[model samples]
Target: IANDNPYKYQRRLASITSATVAELDVAIPDPGLTTAVAVTVSDPIDVENGAMFSVFQAACDHEFAKLIRHKDLRRYHSWYQMKLREALMADQRDETIQNGYMQDSDEWGLPLGEVEY
Candidate 1:
């Protein structure tokens, strides 16, 4: 799931992700512990432990580079664009005092949305 290639509507996350916080103990791979162990995407939790975030980061970095090099968004798959969008929105919303939106006009982004691309 961290690769941004979660596959077919995010189903790959089922083994590791959950809606309830109570189950997070085992469902979520602890970044510190899992980073050192030999892990795989097939692991019951986390593809790289916390290091998988780097995988996702690498994917994003690739898209960014592609955009810079070609001035286009057509090369990457829709899933890549969708995840990037979500990540951007989350980052925008995470700012404590200034999140790049004006209360008077700019609308705060939702955490999730229908893929529009």
Candidate 2:
């Protein structure tokens, strides 16, 4: 059920991801851990939240870089252009913050995907 709470989305998304990741066996070339060991060390790097958030950050970084390099909207002088610039800046800030969150979570042994490409 879709809860009307804004926070529910984040939590629901995490739960879905955990379910999916839980189903996937460790992607190791060889199996070594027994069920007990797996339960203790299993991580979510290959899961939904980590991968999803990583992708978001990567895309944001790419777009921000492109904007800074190209300055494609430089020629414009309109309300729309102003809004675009503001939105892009905000997105960059958000991406940075998300990155920090992911890093901290990963440090705590929550699998946040590899450093985004």
Candidate 3:
């Protein structure tokens, strides 16, 4: 059996997180002998979201030079990149707060003291 394209798997996983398969217009393929299948949809919303995520990930994977060189797509690519960055930062902040790594001024308990040798 041929191995599935890892990129397709990544795209499907991303799509599911951002939108449901139905919302993404993704069609569930009939079970067959093939071990690998590409998950895609005919809906414009699904297509745009999938493409945006793919391009953003490509840029993050060190393909920013190539992505930015496309003048027509630069705007969309930049928007996706910024959105992804913001989402990541928000998630990190939430995680840090939840783990007690961050504290608001009102939540500060005490100040650290310098220890002299």
Candidate 4:
């Protein structure tokens, strides 16, 4: 908390959130966050415009549980890891923008090519 970097608070928040997720064992159903798909696509999904995130959220919510076998948990973890890896990649490379700790909508995720840091 002594550092002066602008992203310090955001980093702290992320750390807390991650820790909470890691420790979570109860799955409280949230109806307001519920969404449904009108149709299923057999073809590949193109997430170039950040559409996959919504699906990810819904899937996680739908799959939430209070407990699981060790084997099942490991399998779930690996599955998520693989899918998340794909989510962050595009054009055969990482599409994640290291835009620092921007807290503002206009400032967050601003590609370095478009503006100076």
> Best-fitting candidate, measured by TM-score?
4
Per-residue accuracy of model 2 over 1-117 as CA lDDT, tens digit each: 233333211111123345435333334333553233323222435524443444444555546655677453332222233333344445555442343233333432322222222
Q: Which residue pairs in candidate 2 collide?
A: none
- What's the lDDT for all of these models? 0.42, 0.37, 0.41, 0.38
Please provide, for model 3 over 47-115, each residue's C-alpha lDDT reduced to its tens digit, 9 standing for 90 to 100. 234545654555564356455565445554445445544444545544433232234544432222111
lDDT of 1 by residue, 1-117 (tens): 466443322123333344331122333344554323333345443443333454486567657856687544444434444454455455554443234322332332322222234
Off by over 4 Å in 4: 1-71, 91-117
Candidate RMSDs in Å, in order, are: 13.8, 16.6, 13.7, 20.7
Q: Rank the candidates by lDDT, best first.
A: 1, 3, 4, 2
Q: Which residue pairs show backbone clashes in model 1?
A: none
- The 10 consecutive residues of candidate 2 with the worst lDDT sum are 5-14
Q: Where's the lowest-lDDT run of ten residues in candidate 1? A: 19-28
**Candidate 4 — worst ten consecutive residues by lDDT sum?**
7-16
Please estimate how well model 3 matches the true structure, expressed as its whole-model Cα lDDT: 0.41
lDDT of 2 at 114: 21
TM-score of each: 0.21, 0.20, 0.22, 0.27
